[model samples]
Target: MTMKRIAPLIVSLMAALVAVLVVGRPEHADAKADANPGAKDVIVHLFEWPWASIASECTNVLGPKGFGGVQVSPPQEHVVLPGAGYPWWQDYQPVSYQLQTRRGDRAAFATMVSTCHAAGVKIYVDAVINHMAGGASTGAGSAGSTYNHYSYPAVPFGNDGFHHCGRNGNDDIANWGDRWEIQNCELVDLSDLRTEAEYVRGKLVAYLNDLISLGVDGFRVDAAKHMPVADLQNIYSRLNGNPYIFQETIEGGAGEPSPSEYTGIGDVTEFRYGDVVGNAFRDGNLSGLQNLPSQMLLASGDAVAFIDNHDTQRNGRAKLTYKDGTNYALSEAFMLAYPYGTPAVMSSFTFSNPEAGPPASSNGTTNAVNCSSGWACEHRWRTTANMVGFHNAAYGTGLSNWWSNGGNQIAFGRGANAYAVFNRGGTLNRTFSTSLPAGTYCDVANGDISGNTCTGTAYTVNSSGQFTANVPANGMVALHINARTTGGVTTPPTGCGTVAVTFASSTTTVWGENVFVLGNRAELSSWNTSGGVALSSATYPVWRGTVDLPANTAVEYKYVKKNGSSVTWESGGNRTINTGSACTLTVNDTWRS
Candidate 1:
């Protein structure tokens, strides 16, 4: 949880709560081993999803899609603000450690974890242990737990169990560089818990053990950056079974506490990964991502990699999201396709209004997710879900056969087990050398393997270990040894080096107006508007096309609109584009409408 709070309500006192168990799982039961699942794990954060929907996705979607696990939102009872439309961040304001949340009750959560585990998928709870609801009186909590700045009867934490925030009139993390202030101070007036106290730690331990008993495999420690690392070590050391724990310690630049401070305690979130990946692809610089800077997160083995998370995606630090369209999807493809850290898929609901909660009832209890109800089920996209299989197939293999067009165009193989080619800034019609046993394999990028048939394109690896294809602009293709089409494998004949060059453009036109692109080159119909290739308006206000063109040629072009006998030419200088020396290139532009 980042420290940014939406709004606040007056806090009150704790109410009668249930007694928590002190002991953890039985002695013989392991915490570490039990929490960590097997290899090729790709954890998807089902942000704010209801427990029932998560269960259904595990059986009908996650299991079949090869997702290793899910990182669910914080399930603790929290403050309910009808006035705020029940912002999703409300989950972070813990009123109690109880697992009953607006998403579902305790029974629902238990069922979800069990169901997911049964389907070979683990459940990682997002543990918000740092603080409680803000304010000092009159709290309105979801689970009916009454809480004040120092009184949470649900956990029965009183004045002594929390920090004296207003004692000397402290500021809300006024200086991020000051470690003491960051740890002890209240975040946006949220009551900071006394994790340093043994009493609080015991309650937290019991809560976590309870979750483990309910079949939770691990936890994502929220706002860990705001808590003491030593205290965290203490809490983990007292646990019964080793639950996989990854702390949410966002590296907010140099002045913030180094994420390394909490590294030995558990796996940490590497926020730098997304920003770097986004910038590289956005700027058409592929090689930049491969060579990470020292300041960036490079300990891939011990870090969690993602294109964006809830906070960064909403707060503008994350460079890409569903809103970015093609580039957004491209980031995920590139991340998963690369042999780096464990990848996480972001599955979130759509909201033009950032503070709005998930699809919910009038009371803010989230309704079951149905994709059509304003949720972006990105994990279900063929491009994302299918890549999980490829990531699994290529696990533990070292990167080999690295090749690049010295620009954004690149291709590489995973030790002959799999191959991937990427093209941005234009098209990619280049061949790369490989060492695979010649055979036909499904291009997992286009689609998944349905039994013996590849739902995508089929490519044959030549006897000499070479792959040839023309990836369209903002497109890519992938193949793995494990995903070979039944008869897709074959020996390649001689002469396999050329790739298709696709010329493309985008423009906005009013209704009834069609856009056409023509240029001063043979590929552009020799600048003849009537003979020019027709652009598709299937995506209204935008047009695109892929055309076969001679490689290594420079051309000038412009867009023209036609409707019956009427015609409109873009009023501007002739646009110039280049076909790279390689077999592919892309000319991207917008009409000067």
Candidate 2:
């Protein structure tokens, strides 16, 4: 459950029916692929991290680690419960769609998205749309919008906006087993929005589209199970573009609106997969993880996998977590190395009390995240970070040359591209066959390659394509074609993936006047009007340039027709282009909208 603190039992209801997604079914289906078209396939859940911190992390840790995307905490304005020590769950109680919160203002959020996307890291905002503030409180929201139990002025939602489940103005879901009541009733004291109302659906879709326009790659539909699937299909159908959408339909066991019911819309978080991976790692059972509980879940292509989310970590239901130390790392390594479903790594702030808020600044707003400051930052750990790269290098390839010591130990190759081994129990010597063509390789799990030198243990595979090595207890070792230094079947690391920019100008241009792209991004021109990358007018009407940029990047550039000393800039908002997972992508856009 993404929301916990205040009402554990209510979240319990959420955690039960936790995840769902689908694609390749029909027009209703989102594409049958990972969120980001060609991303690393590893999405990190940076829970409650401040915007600037998230930006810094995207550039330094996450981008370099090859993480495809970041699932940031909800960015919408919400309740600020200082009276309750400002519980973290308070943010989950959204008061309005205003992009203002303890994290940052609307501008900060937009910058964070562009920055992360520029670094090849997609941003998936946690969208808490199922309900608003739970208790019957009368106060101004974080964005200074006044709100009550049945009224929210920021979104201008009134009495007609909420569901009338009837209980002294509160409609608590007394019976979770009843699908209708669960969907229509209030979760705790929270006022459930009447999503069936056209006004409500429009407002919600508009808010989501605003984020998409701001450049977010996708969304985590918080408490999606609480809303009717039909309402969801309508809302998503009307989105600007197919942004990555995964829902939180937490009715765990087989029951009403099975995960398949939501599959036609977007990817679903397979909570059961988390339980399986967590338990297997915690208990050192490699075989149990081989066959997942796919009977009642969506297909691998439709599922978002995670080891332990916010709620499961706090509620003691997860098998491994930051508290578990080595076991947690081992489990995460397994999650990435194994090709089960789209993985989401949880990077939460360290908290002693479940209800405790983030480290606040002097103004009581969430402080700038300092990983050293009680934040788990699990996504930055050596094992997890390197595994992200391993996953990237290995994705699009299926498992081969699979080897297991029958139970607690296992080693597998992602075709011939990657090979990883995990020794959950007491380990020493073991030999495994791999598709790799016999060569010395660097063990990225221990230390990555620098220059062309290996910083850690180097394993040499014989001509027979077999390597014998001793793995540590509860240790993980991963080596992929993308991690190799010198020889072998390694593909040189494509650093700072590039994107192609083609500008088609509608403006009148003379023989001497040439169109050039310039922007605040260094790749564009460092905002220098004169030094902007000149576009080729091979085809008089269109100008183009293949610009090298960081993967998953966003650039705000404008086309300017330059004749030498003088320049005519496009008179409009800066045109933006967000790059994807490809080594190089093409952005065909007009000069100015």
Candidate 3:
């Protein structure tokens, strides 16, 4: 779909590929799937979204919803193919290393990166390093740089910098059977860079280093299979820091490059994951979905899982996409709830033509995203967005309380923190067993939880950690400890003088975890983890939040790290704070643990 000419081939060859263990990854490829530890673990690919739009979304939706990172489309000067109707794939053809594209200019891109970081969201760029513009695209590029086959001058690559494999009379990759040609020759007549050469590698490293200097946290290596593993390893080693790196390696036939071969360099996008998980939901089968990790090609830590992506959604390879309606929603929810690989949710724009670009001007400058009109915004769907909380809440816990109806119904629990049930057959009323504590929980799947109330459905778990409810057909019921109903700060007792107390905690955290302040007082949620006042990571390494408290009162409080389902209390005893008669006060403390 992106002019790689490999999508259809990979899709048809999926049946022949086999899953293998990934071993012998290079030591330099210590790229983690979760770039920002202690943040949420989900990465939403806002495909073709403008830089400015992404910044706003980070502050408004992603940060609030607990998403970890965003895989943005390429942010470099690329080819502009107006004659081809300004196809979406045009962005894949590079004209230069300049950070100027349809998305925005260099200044805007830098602002986006800073804005997202301030909101606790990391940015992963889609790095297209396999080749430059195709030989047929002869003209000025998006940033007015002109180039021909192997003659780009902006980055100053010449014919000597490319690989002319001298095969098939045109030097194009006509045979996928040959491993050398697949990696060295031009893909679809695009000029392939000689990655083995030190000069070429240096140029590539500079491009990547430039992005890293701009505070880009990670990269989705586009068309990584075209470059050898050694070349990638060498390039990665040269990076300033170990930002998260996941490559797009479409599994090929037996002799061709295997996705497993690239795992040593970094995480690989497990295309097979989409097939196994998507088909399970599309077929309405819940029996075999639990064993997904063992069935995947890469290990849980090395795989980047997704139900559908930009390429698959355009091609017919994807089992269920945004077009599939409820089935797709259920599939996304299941992917999040199930403990598998690192999840990257897809948020895309609507398109009937697989080659069509997003809504843009005649000059191919992409317009700002408008979700209600052209964008699918699948990540914002109630079932998908709310499930992120479930994923975070259930982090580090293993699946328990597994139950199935031997048909299209299933229920499971994530330790004692979260529980969920899916009903695809019919409205089945049943009492579900769980390990959650007794409390009234908001069913996040059907509604949003605000304060202590649920906007839609609510269920009460008894002391035995069991709840009785009728799950609707084609629906789900999800509850996490964070969504429990609890009355918080009951109108700060009538005549008490209030002072704004700002709590600042300097502590580090792992993925899916956040810092909160709670204490033994009505104003501080009374030590209820569910009702604790959450601190923001706007100024990271320093979690800060302000809350009103009774003046001139001694409050026993402590900072705790909370994921959705579990709470990790600070070591030692409780921290005591005094709210003086001053109108406002600030308390700065380090993490005791």
TM-score of each: 0.77, 0.81, 0.78
- Assess each prediction's global lDDT (C-alpha) against the native: 0.72, 0.73, 0.79
lDDT of 3 by residue, 1-593 (tens): 24442110001112112100111123344332233222256999998888999999988887677677899999988887777787788888888888999889998998998777656577899998888777775787778887777777676655667789997887888888889999988888877888776666666777887787677777999989888888888778766444678899988896688989887778889999899988888988887877778888899878889999999988789999999999999999988898887899999888899988888777776654557667889999999999988888888888999989987999999999899999888898999999988888889999888765679888989989999989889989998887887422311122213455678899899876888899998657799977676676656789876565767999999999987589999998989878876545789999987
Task: Point out where model 2 deviates above 4 Å.
Answer: 2-37, 167-169, 254-256, 293-296, 489-492, 496-593
Against the hidden true structure, what lDDT does model 1 obtain? Answer: 0.72
Task: List model 2 lDDT by residue over 513-571, tens digit each.
Answer: 87777887865668787566556554457665444455677778777878758888878
Worst 10 residues of 1 by lDDT: 491-500
Strongest candidate by TM-score? 2
Error of 3 at 259 (Å): 1.6
TM-score of 3: 0.78
Worst 10 residues of 3 by lDDT: 7-16
Using lDDT as the measure, which candidate wins?
3
The residue-by-residue lDDT of candidate 1 on 1-593, one tens digit each, is 65346222122233212222333223232122212334637999999998999999888888766687899988888877777777887888888877778888999998897677656677889998888877633465677877666566667766666676553374366776777788888887777878876667777877886776566767899899989777887777655345678888877655677787777777888888888888877777886555553436647666788888888777778788888877888788877778777788898788787777888878787755567678898888777887787787678787788888788887787887788887785877777788776888888889767667776798888989987898998888888876786433432211112213333456766656667778887546688766564565534455654444444567788888887578889888988766544423446666675
